[model samples]
Target: MTRSRAQTRLMLAILGAVFAFLYVPISVLFALSFNEGGLPTAWTGFSTKWYGELLRNADIMGAAWNSLIVAVASTVIATVLGTLLAIGIEMRRRKGRLVETLVFAPMIIPDIVLAIALLSMFSLAGVRMGLHTIIVSHVVFNLAFVCAVVRARLRSFDWSIVEASTDLGAPATVTLRRVILPSLLPAVIAGALLAFTLSIDEFIIAFFTAGAGRSSITLPMQIFAMIRFGVTPEINALATIVMTLSLVMLAISQRLNRGSLPGQ
Candidate 1:
């Protein structure tokens, strides 16, 4: 009984410390966001003025639009390709090490390496750098993530049902449309949300490939620029909201995927 109680106390202490470490900074930022004086030591009163100012900021709005466009386009493209790639790779019993390496290279390779490589390739090919370029570059990494998520869902998926559907005289297209898609929809959705979140948060690659303009600036790029001007209550509000949204979406994605990832 003593050992159990001691262990319980130790676990609670660790958990409490972990939570405080993770949330204290965020709590401070949130409190500062509402401070009427915008000073850490002084709190005149709570106010929503920073959020209102953010709404009125044209530069932030424009950059947000660009980020949305890049995120949506990349997510759509990655979802389709990743889903198909997951199915294709799974169909192969013996995955060549090269194929595995190539498929996952974008995820493992350093961001600067991929960024520079894309820049060089684009310059070499005379591809105009723009939002489209950013979208295309995003897919290189986003697709790998989406593929991994979907592949996990497919890991324990029974193929016998597919065989049965085929034996029942359903054509390949019909079976895929009616049988495969239904089982795969949840995983596909989880992967897509994950992709969208990544595309939205991506910075280094977008910064290099965005081709030097505030016109193609993404939210993270905008936030980075704003940070150079010193942190403001407005930025704190924006950061908090962005972080909250990312965390919520990721939480939902994890819920859908559950313990299926990593072959567990």
Candidate 2:
């Protein structure tokens, strides 16, 4: 009994340490976001002034709007194309390893490599890098995630219902709308949210594809530019807001997925 008690205590200690390692820095940053002095070393009471300043900052707001546009456009395109692609892939009786690898390549590829490749492709193709290009680039990677999420939901999906609808004289479009899509809606929404968060946070790809312009700057890019100038109170506030948004989206995605995401 003493030995078992000691083991349990050690396990609890390890768990506590792991939690602290993961969250202590984030907790400190969160606390400093509200610090009136805005310094990590010193706390001069709490304030929400930085958040107000963030809202009033035109450059930040513009970049935020640009990020929103990219995220929304990419999510929408990825969701539709990805859902169809997932359905088509899942319908195949014999899935090949090559096909699977190709489909999942975007998810596994290094961001820097992908960004450089995209930049080269665009340059060779004479495609002007702008918001449209960013949306297109984002869609390429986002679709893989959306497809994976939709495919996970499809694992337990019933094909018979779709067959029955077809036998009952329903059109393919009607069956998809009334039967297949309704069942896949939860995963679809979750995938969209996930894609939105990723696109919003993606920096390297957007930076490479954004080309020469202040017009296409995104929130992540804006944050990077600010950090280069030196960390400010506004950065803490911006970081907090961005992190909170990401957490909220992730929480919603997990809730909607009911714990069954792509890999799990």
Candidate 3:
């Protein structure tokens, strides 16, 4: 009992240290975001002025809108394609190893490598790089994530229901719409939320694919530009908002994909 207790205490200490390492800086940054003077030296009292300033900045708002557009567009496209692809792959009798690798390649590939390759492809094809291109680029990896989630849900799915629906003379489309879709909805939504979060925070791919000009700047890009000039209070506020939004979305994703996520 003494040895077990000692081991447990050591594990708990390690866990606490890990959590502190990960969240302490984030906590400090969040706390500083509310500091009126915007300096780390001392607290100048709590204030929401920086958030108000963020709201009033036209460039920030425009970049936020651009990020929203790209995220939404990419999420929608990826969800549909990924869901269908997952369904199709799951129905196969033999899953090809090479095919599986190809499907998931985007998820594991380095973002900068993918970004450069996409930029090269777009340039070679003479496609105008803009929000549209960014959406397309995001869809490449986003779909892989969606597919993974949906495929997890599919693994435990009862294929016999689909078979029964077909046996009942239900059309393929009808079976899919009525039987398969209902079961997959939670995982689908979870995947889509994850994709949206990734797209919103993604910078490198969007930067490369978004072409020249202030028109295509995303929230991440804008934040990067702001930081280059020096750390300002507005950035703290923006970071707080982005971090809060991402955490909220991630929580929802975890809830929805509770059993479907890997190593759950």
Candidate 4:
């Protein structure tokens, strides 16, 4: 009994240490965002001035709007294309390993490598780098993610119903609309939310594809520019807000992917 108690205590200690390592810095940053003095090491008092400052900053607001545009556009495109691709792959009986690898290559590739590759491809194609370019790049990155999510849901899908619908003389379009799509709706929405979160937080690909202009600058790029000087309270506030939004989206996506409603 003593030995088992000692082992349990050790496991708990390790778990506590892991949690502290992961969240202590984030907790400190969250706390400092409300610090009136705006110093990392010193806490004068609690204030929401930093959040207000973030709202008042024109550059931050512009970058945020740009990010919103890119994320929404990319998520929409990726969700549609990825869903179709997922359905195509899942419906095939003789799925080749090569085809699967090609489809999921983006998810496997390192972000920096993919970003540089995209930049090179754009340059070779003589494509102008702008918000449009960022949107395309994000679609490329997010496509694999959306496909993976939807494909997981498809694995457990009831294909017999689809066959029955088709056997009933339903056309391909009608069968897909009435049968497959409705069943995949939750997964599709989950994938879209996940893709939106990724596109919003993504920095390397957006940075490379965004080109040289304030007009195309995204929130992550703007945050990078600010942090180059040093971390400020305003930056902390912005980070907190972004992190919270991402967590919320991810939580919702997970719930939907599990085919459950929130608070259920």
Among all candidates shown, the one with the greatest lDDT: 4
Alpha carbon lDDT of each predicted model: 0.90, 0.92, 0.94, 0.95
lDDT tens string, model 1, 1-264?
Answer: 999999999999999999999999999987888887777777899998888899999999999999999999999999999999998998898989899889989999999999999999999999999999999999998999999998898897888999999999999889888988788888888999999999989999999899777879999999999999899888988887788888888998888888555566
- C-alpha TM-scores of all predictions: 0.93, 0.95, 0.97, 0.96
The candidate that wins on TM-score is: 3
**Model 4 CA deviation exceeding 4 Å by range:** 259-264
lDDT tens digits by residue: candidate 2, 1-264:
999999999999999999999999888878888999888788999899989999999999999999999999999999999999999899899999998999999999999999999999999999988999999999998999999989999988879999899999999889989999999999999999999999989999999999677899999999999999788989988998999999999999878877444445
**Backbone clashes counted, model 2:** 0
lDDT of 1 at 72: 95
Q: Give the Å error, residue 221, model 3.
A: 0.4
Cα miss at 134, model 3 (Å)?
A: 0.4
True-vs-predicted CA distance for residue 218, candidate 1, Å: 0.3
Error of 4 at 88 (Å): 0.4
Q: Candidate 2: global Cα-lDDT?
A: 0.92
Positional deviation of 240 in candidate 2, in angstroms?
A: 0.3
